[model samples]
Target chain A: MATLMDRVITSKAAVLEGSRAIAEAVRLCRPQVISAYPITPQTHVVEALAQMVADGALKAEFVNVESEHSAASVVLGASATGARVYTASSSQGIALMSEVLFNIAGLRLPVVLTCANRALSSPLNIWNDQQDSLSVRDAGWVQLYVEDNQEAVDTHLQAYAIAEDRRVLLPTMVCADGFLLTHTYEPVIVPTQEEVDAFLPPYRPQHYLTPDKPLTMGAFADPEYYMESRYLLDRALERSQAVIEDAAQRFNRAFGRHYGGLLDTLHMEGARTAVVAMGSVVATLRDVVSGLRDDGHAVGLVKVRSFRPFPKDALRSALRDVDRVLVLERALSPGGVGILAAEVRAVLQGQPRQPAVSAFVAGLGGRDIPVETLQALIARAQDEAVEQGFADLKAELVEEGDEDES
Target chain B: MKTRVEPAPELLSPGHTACRGCGLLVAARLALQAAGPRVIVANATGCLEITTSKFPQSSWNVPWIHSLFENTAAVASGVEAALKALGRQAEARVIAQAGDGGTADIGLQSLSGMLERGHDVLYICYDNEAYMNTGIQRSSLTPLGARTSTTPPGALSWGEVRTKKDMPAIAAAHGIPYVATASIAYPPDLVKKVKRALGIRGPKYLQVHSSCPLGWGHDSSLSIRVARLAVQTGLYPLYEVINGQLTNVKRLSYRSPVAAYLKPQRRFEHLFKPGGEALLAQVQALANANAAKYGFPPVTEGAEAEDSD
Candidate 1:
């Protein structure tokens, strides 16, 4: 046991739910603290982790906190003391954890939270959506959205590596769509302890609170020094792109799983129309675009994985060949256009040649969007591309009197 | 066994910007000094954090962190959990310190969560009553008939009409291993409680009745004197509950009249006026009830009101 702390277990491809795969990835990381509250979609991930600890498969302190706020705080405190920690939450749970999320990132603690993406409440719904995490895009956390269970598992391993990287030192949120990915069972590779040990080394906290070496963290900053601290944090996050990319590269080389940098692409070369989306929707778009290609339509798919850093240059380069870009967003900014579409447009700005971006908002509050809907969005983008497009809005759900006619 | 002042160097050194004679820092000094250098303080955003650690300079000689106003207890829980995870629980101690507002009100949920989780953390609430860091706003711990910026005296209302929330009792209700109340006027006892709480392996609570000269409307030099009166009047009892049992009590010699304690602070100055007499009587009734609850053996009555300053 002393000769490396842990001997690697050879990874096995087994059918597992996305939540269980995330839990398995966390077990490999050897988190010292696991504090989480039960929220739909997110509940399974933490429950599986708790069972692992209970079964002695994972040796860690599993603290079942009362609420998301305390769960976040428990990890924040533990991380400050140089402990590798993990927590899971979603939707209202994530919203409740928002304050601590900012604190964790601000303190530059390398904590990781598995966010099983769910929609926010009232009229209270518990289904999958990206709005929960997307709403906190500016909270200074490294947000990595994945395509499927395999990618979700892979990203969880990478999240720990990148977050604990000395250059990055930022909290990471591994986002996998609720119900769609979290509940759906799929084949996943569980890396051996030896392989994980070789890929991601033991967490050596860059900064920590220790009694022997006394230092003050989270000190009060007056007008003179406040902005500089935030400026430094911003710079650190800005530099994390290289660290994230490097970690992904090293993981691919070691484990035979490739996550192409901050953003991934498919057939953007010589294409006139590209469908852009994040999380599981990106996978759906990929298959839909592939079928459309055989039908003589010039189409491609842009899979946005890193939503926090926004991957501006990667996104700009990927969409350069496309003429009409259909941005499929599962979340709407309410009174504004599509969340992902707005971001894609903003990042694509000032590039020499940019595509005409069309925004489509659907799949909200776990509403199903079938293949026909994707085909409809493609046709709309190819013909009359426009921003702020609503797909499958269920027009009859709204009474004619719901809107006041002038 | 009585706790004597042990030989030790100053932990909370001079040059701090705390209002001169403010007992909050004195309580902090005694507690930190007692814990020695083997402790890390997870402080909430209040007087202690705001006064010390202004960027490049820090008065702390021990590892300390200030995460947020309401989450210090939870932060300390994390620290303690981490130490345990690293097989270093015995190498260091974790303490969460916050002001009254952070303890009894806005921060209560986090503090309660920490205690319930049974984290090996020593949580100290420096009770200076109202939100002193935010200019003496009303807090749940603020005593009845005390003036504050939010609960100011008026023609229709007496300041802070609700009785003070029993924070130590609330902590004891968590069924933690240790819960205690101490006061800055008695440094030896407060320091002893801090030491005793640290010796325990599970969650511990030490609510020190720290005094704020600015917020309490008292002369800065009389901070300790006022703290002593609070205990003497039975408004703030010095006692300890170990393993869900009241194990120790620093019995008062004689129940001091509440008026003697109230008259010195401007926050209670309204009671000195004609219309404030009835409110003062109610405050006195509260002290009497507290005395009966603790049931301390009464001794000498009316001691001389010595003006130490």
Candidate 2:
């Protein structure tokens, strides 16, 4: 007779189903509290876990909060009291919870959140993109982007380890492409329960409510103290990159899976041309790299994983050898260049012999980016670098009349 | 030492920077006394948060946290939840305190959420009628015809045109276990309400009329006297709502006219000046209506223990 754990494992191998993989990963982490609200695309992640809790597959306290703000607050409260807490939201849900998001980080609560990247609403489009997470880039969270279902599951498991590390007791966001990574089905290899238990330990709050050792978690800081409080938070965030790298390295050794660093470089060896991107687009870029390589083009791809500490040194190293680098951003920074483009440029400033970095602001508001378009962008950047040297390149829309005349 | 049932220890100590005779200080001290030492206060960004906690200093003897401008209820809810999870629920009581601006305007949503979720927490709103910290800006709870930084007395307008927000009624609408309005002038009643709220099972809201001298433009020494005048005039009536039903109104003896409350504060001075008698009359009418609705019996001179069913 098989045991209960075996009975639940109908499909033994790792499945690459989008939201299910995320749910499975969270289950592996075994969070004590899960507070969530229903938001489009992101709802399935929490809903699946809720069902698991009800079905006795996951033993957890699933708090059905009324709004996104309360959901974040519930998790913060639960996490502060030393319970491992998890929550998921998207788009306006994130915006609604923005005030508490800063408090959670400022208080240094190690809560793990999953953001199903979606567009902020005015016309209310609930689909896929990076606008939501990028908008809160200054919120002092360790942001990690996942390329696929496997990474989504793996990253969430790793997020807990990194976030709860004594040196980096801060909140983290596991950002996945909405619908693309949330709804799509794929094969994912889930680790055994015993293996996961060994990989990630139980949460132990550094400064929780204890009668034996009384301490204040969040206190009012006046002008003289407020600046130092913020400075400490900034220092903690800057120190998280090393913690993330160490956790990822340990996770790889234990599970036999390797994710490079805060920034991951791909096919950049001896390449003078590259396209820098994040999230699901990295998979598309990998395909583009293969197509370009088959056509005898020296092109590579760079994927940013840790977005908060930003991995400036790693990015500089990745782009140092490349003569031309094209940046693809899925979110706009309004009147300025795209958020990622601005950050990459800031990192490259005054560096020794930098690449001619060009920006392609595409796939915004859930707009799909085909492999063909990504290839064309790479080709355009190479041509622009050859013609304009190190001059900045903007997206050039192809005129319809010109194509018709041709 | 005087023998008394109340603990003599000062939970909210002296040397704090509340204005002379500031009713908020008295209310805070009495409420903290009633709550005792094992209390965790979640203070919102307001006058209390500013004056009590000024960089490497704190007036509270109990553990406290000062969250953002709003969401003290939410933060308090978290503290309660944390305590419950840690199996130390009985060790301390969670109390969220904020000003009228933070409570009635910006924090209503979070407060509602806390009450609806049935968290074991007590929220206190120190109602000084305006945003005292941001230089006395008009807030939702600021009474009508009061001159504030935002609602100035101009040629076209007398002062604030809108009446004070009915916060206790709104809180009662949340179906909380206990909801009450108390004045700093009635310290014993305020302390009793605080003790009652702490014993409740679910969320409780106490709206205390804490007089602000700077915002009201009153003589600093007359803050408590002004607060007492408000209750005597029936402008700021003391009442309690239990389980969504009105009960136990502290009807004063010898109910004074609205002028007794209006004359002392410069914020309400505009209502008494030239062509402002209409606004004053409107304020009087509102006070009468409140007294009648809450069954506030007119107090007679030297008469005590007035009660009506």
In model 1, pairs of residues that clash are: A8-A193, A8-A194, A9-A192, A9-A193
Instruction: Show model 1 residue runs off by greater than 4 Å.
Output: A1-12, A400-406, B1-4, B296-309
The residue-by-residue lDDT of candidate 1 on A1-406, one tens digit each, is 0011111233467889888888999899889888899999898899999999999999898888878998999999999998999999999999998998988888899899988999998888999888899988878999999988888888988999999888889999999999999999987878888888888888988678987788889887888988998898888888988888898889878877775778877767778888888888877776688788878788888788888777888888888877889888888798887788888999888888877888888788998888889998888888866767667765577654322110
Alpha-carbon lDDT of model 1: 0.86
TM-scores, all candidates, are: 0.95, 0.91
Q: Once superposed on the true structure, which residue ranges of model 2 sit more than 4 Å away at CA?
A: A1-11, A14-16, A56-59, A209-217, A220-226, A386-406, B1-5, B298-309
Question: How does residue B175 of candidate 1 score in lDDT?
Answer: 95
lDDT, candidate 1, residue A353?
81
Clashing pairs in 2: A14-A188, A14-A189, A15-A187, A15-A188, A16-A186, A16-A187, A16-A188, A17-A186, B253-B299, B254-B299
- Candidate 2: docking tier: acceptable
Error of 2 at A283 (Å): 1.2
**lDDT tens digits, residue span B103-200, model 2:** 98988888888888888999999999999989999999999899999999998989899999899988888888999998877777887899999988
